[model samples]
Target: MTGARMRVALSARGVEVDDGAGGVLAPWGDVDRVTAFALGTVRYVSFDLVNGHSVEVDDGAPEWDEMVAALPAHVDGGVDDLPAALAALAHDDPVLVVGAPVLPR
Candidate 1:
């Protein structure tokens, strides 16, 4: 999705991304995995759905910081080193923030 105009947040049901006109609502149960990373000056969070689709949002999103802070509480098996990875703006290797290391398809 477009980065700057996006608004990502953790709703009571799951993750929501509003892009002004319309948005996507990925319910918690539909999410099979999650990842986070940073590249240049942008930090990203990706939600991988059980249906094999995905949604990604970046630091440009309005509620990005809030979504990142609330991730550990909402997701299971999230990596503890997320803060470190996100701080490394020069790197882009995605860090697992939820679900198993190897997803079961």
Candidate 2:
């Protein structure tokens, strides 16, 4: 039998470094939101169900604000981009949430 490799969840809290032309990038800053690994200001994990897909994000609110504050410059994104209580099985997993309030087409 072929054994499947285990995948550790990538919980890198960040903000959307947008191009300002309507595109964005990452590491606005990465954060840890495992609750137990309370390394930064991780507020409530934001989650949303859109287009039949469920997405959760952590944006340092009530707690996560510190992570967002440390950045030199960043844009505010919705529940999906915060990278909070969210989970992704693999790289190929569908990213239902992208920008703030913008759902996958």
Candidate 3:
């Protein structure tokens, strides 16, 4: 998440993240889901992989809007209440944007 400017891109293969230092490719078949949360005014988006790891990108990065807009193409249920979820950032809760909505208790 830290490094020059971040770049997030979507492709037929999957989500690609480049932080200027290095890059990570989260393939479509390997992705478990996607999640988003806000800390202060910044929004953090994560691509959760089936292998138990994840890649995160922030709103400060370029292509952030494009990536968010393209989520529905790759993730089930996409982000139905993104505006509302972001509005509730003061509560500091991470919302599930894809796959299932339920979070662990």
Q: Give the alpha carbon lDDT tens digit for every residue of 1-105 in model 3.
A: 633576778776787877778887777777777777777777777778789987777777667677767666666674566545544555366564655222223
Quote each prediction's TM-score: 0.73, 0.19, 0.71
Sort the candidates on TM-score, descending order: 1, 3, 2
Sequence-dependent TM-score of model 3 = 0.71
Considering only N, C-alpha and C atoms within 3 Å, which residue pairs clash in candidate 1? Answer: none
Which pairs, if any, clash in model 2?
13-31, 41-63, 41-64, 42-64, 43-64, 58-84, 60-64, 60-65, 61-64, 78-100
> For candidate 1, what is the lDDT?
0.69
Candidate 3 colliding pairs: none
Worst 10 residues of 1 by lDDT: 96-105
lDDT of 1 by residue, 20-82 (tens): 789878788788888776667777778888899878877776676777677766766646755
How close is each model in CA RMSD to the real structure? 4.4, 14.4, 5.6
The best candidate in terms of TM-score? 1
Task: State the TM-score for model 2.
Answer: 0.19
| Model 2 Cα shift for residue 83 (angstroms) | 3.0
